[model samples]
Target: MKESSATLRDLRPTQFAVGMIHVRRKMAETRAVCADSRYAFMEQRAIAVVRGPGGVLHVIDHHHWARAWIELGIERAPVQVKMDFRDLDDIDFLAAMMERGWVHPFNERGEKVDIGTLPPSIAQMPDDPYQSLAAFLRIARVFENPGEFNAKFAWADYLREHVSGDSGTIEGFAEMLATAFRFAHTPEARALPGYRPEAAR
Candidate 1:
């Protein structure tokens, strides 16, 4: 319930993995969009965080942006507190976050992980290739809604089931993306977030 600016180093990530491709994309954008002044760019993008046990600020969104700032050696960004669960114990705090869709404690392979093992910071979060694919799918305007919390992660889970054999190369990602794009339009994907059934035709 508070909004303020905070140093990037202090913002803890709520997930164990991020689409590294997406992070790299943001990195490139940082140089292009905010090259003149990172601070000014940050002022325009305020990430959302929830106060957890011991008053830790857990990032709920814009995980890529936070990583970009730290990698670019930028110091801080504006953060808006969406909730305060500090009064709850560690277990209860995490439960609240998950219930509110504020935390996604899944790994690259779309496996559920203990929330306690969430990356200590955004910089340490590992890569989730399917996550990258899901993000690009969103950008392609291939679906609808796209508003629920962690919706992209939901797509990531779906992609993980339909696509496989990631070589972790750009070319490999392109191949996977092509396949995923097709699978995205199928009836099975209709249940996922941001599904525009008409887009299939």
Candidate 2:
């Protein structure tokens, strides 16, 4: 449960879903590197996991990177155990995780989900297109991280209200980006974790 290697397939996902576009982008980037280079790349970014009840490993961060590794057919990746909550029961364990912002119990539609029902692995995480939109907004510098856990997700939750559907094309994502930008600066969005009014200019 320390700094060591683990099977990518065996690591449990703390969240129910992720921005698959982000995961796909990482997959493409990782695929471009040579085998040895990819090994070094992953080595440098060892995934951080938390040892939960029954000694289950739950990824706390870098979900995109972890997903990319598995999708690329890499068998193993380095992981570090940041916390050990195996002593706590399920209820107490979840509470402790939330207290430290280590769990994401949200799903594809941005609705809160039960952590017990989360996907067994990142490979199975459903796509939250709105989650992708929130990510794209950050990449475009339209949404800046407010130094909080799941900041993009908070924005995604708000975007879920006004945006829906994905055409699954470059042009379509661009259009969605445009639509999201209009609301990214609105007074209502000001309450979101990544809200920044000055960036409206």
> Which candidate number would show the highest TM-score if scored against the true structure?
1
- lDDT over C-alpha atoms for residue 140 of model 1: 84
lDDT of 1 by residue, 7-118 (tens): 8998999888888888888889878874668657776678888887888888988898898778888787889898888899988886787787777767776788887778
Please report, as a residue range, the 10-residue window in candidate 2 with the lowest summed lDDT: 141-150
Cα-based RMSD of the predictions, in order? 1.9, 2.1
lDDT by residue for model 2 (113-174), tens: 77788999878988887878888788877667766566887888888898755548878877
Q: Pick the candidate with the highest lDDT.
A: 2
Candidate 2 residue runs with Cα over 4 Å from true position: none
Query: Worst lDDT window (10 residues) for model 1?
Result: 142-151
All candidates' lDDT scores?
0.82, 0.83
Inter-residue clash pairs, candidate 1: 144-194
